[model samples]
Target: DGRCLKDIHCLELAEFRWTLKQAFGSSQPSARYGHTAAVWPPESEIPGRDKDSEFLFVFGGHSAVSELNDFFAFHIESSTWVKVDTGRQTSGPSKRFAHKWDWSGLKT
Candidate 1:
C-alpha cells in the first residue's frame, strides 16, 4: 500500500530494544513521511509529570496528497498527542518535507 501511517514505535536504549507503541492518544498526526521530529525541551522536566517524561515535537511532513506544516507534540509518559498552533501573529515556515529541525537554538 502507498498509504501513510500514524503508528508509533519506541526504542529503549537501556535494553537495546525496539517496541511498537499502541493505544495512543486519539488526536495524532496524519500518516506522513519526511517529517521532522525531536525530543523537545531537552533534558528538562515537564510540569506535573515525572522527571523522565518528555515530549516529542513533530513538524512538517508529506501526506499522500501534499506537504504539511502542521505541528504536534506527543507526551511520552501519557501516550498523548496534541496539535500545536503556530499563531497568526508570527509567520512560520511554509509547508515542506524532508527538512531538518535544529535544536541547538530551537531553530527550524
Candidate 2:
C-alpha cells in the first residue's frame, strides 16, 4: 500500500507470505505502469523457475506525457534487470495502455 522503490516482491505460497525479492545488479528497468508482463512468452517458450529463461518481461507502457515503447526483462534467477533491445529503430507496436497480455498461442 505504499511505494515499491523498484523492489520486486515474490509471493511465498508455501508460507503464505510476501517476500521482497533480493535484487542485484543495476541495469533494472525504470518504474513504469500500463505496460505488459508475462511469465511465459507468447508461446510456452521456457517455463518459469527454469535454468535458461527465468525472466519477467515488461514491455510498452504509458508515461505522464505519452505512450512508451520500451522493453525490459527481469531475470528472477539472477535478480537483475536488462533492457531488451527489440532491434526496432521505429515503432514496434501500436501505443497502448491499461491492457493485459496473455498467451493464447497467438499474438497478445
Candidate 3:
C-alpha cells in the first residue's frame, strides 16, 4: 500500500530502545516508503535567528503507481511538516531509494 506513518517515534537511548509515541502536526508527508532520511542536529549552522532547531528531511520514494522525487521537512521545535518545492522534477535528482545525504566541510 501507499500508506505512510506520520507518527514520530519516541526513544530511550540510554536503554538502547524506543517506544512508539503518538504525535500530530498540521500536515504530513504523503503516504510513502523507501525514502531516505537525514537530520541536522539542533543548534547547528542555519540561516536566520532560529534556536533549538532539529530537522528531519525525507526524500525520494515510490508509491503503487509512480516514483516520487518530493521532499518533506519536519521541524522539531514547532512539531510540523513542511513540503519543500524543489522546482521542476526534470532538473532534480531522479527518483531513487537507499540514498545518503550529508554535509561536507564548513563553507561559508
Candidate 4:
C-alpha cells in the first residue's frame, strides 16, 4: 500500500476524465516520487525522427529507499518509455527529489 508506482495516467480534455496509459518499452524507470517531468522541443518535431511523436522527459526522484538521478523519456504517440544514458564520461547530476524543471524555448 505504501509502494511507489511507475504507472502513468493521462487526462482527456474532451472526455474530462483520466485514463491509464498502457506503456511499453525495453526498460522502465523504477517507481518514484518527487520527480520532475517536462515536454521538450515544444510544438516541434525531433530531427531525424517521425514528426508524430513527442517526448516527455522525466528526471530525479526518490525511490522507496533512496533518491535517484536517472533520466528517461516517454514517447507519447508510441506509448513507450526509453531510458536516457548520460554516458560514462559524465557523472551527471546527483541523486535528488522534489525538484522542479522548466524549459526555456531559447533559440540560437
TM-score of each: 0.80, 0.70, 0.66, 0.81
lDDT of 1 by residue, 6-71 (tens): 778899889999988763666689999989998866653344655356788999899999999899
Better of 2 and 4 by TM-score: 4
Assess candidate 2 and give its TM-score to the true structure: 0.70
For residues 53-73, what per-residue lDDT tens digits would candidate 3 score against the true structure? 667788877665566788888
Shift in Å, residue 19, candidate 2: 1.2
lDDT agreement with native, every candidate: 0.81, 0.68, 0.68, 0.82
Model 3 clash count equals 0
Better of 3 and 4 by lDDT: 4
**Tens digit of per-residue lDDT, candidate 4, span 18-76:** 99999899878999999998766565435566545567889989999999989999998
Model 3 root mean square deviation, Cα atoms? 4.4
In model 3, how large is the Cα lDDT of residue 97?
A: 63
- Residue-level lDDT tens digits of model 2 in 20-70: 887666667655567788764432553453545557887777765677677
Question: What lDDT score is found at residue 97 in candidate 4?
Answer: 94
- Deviation of model 3 at 102, angstroms: 3.1
Best by TM-score: 4
Once fitted onto the true fold, the runs of candidate 4 whose alpha carbons sit more than 4 angstroms away are: 43-51, 106-108
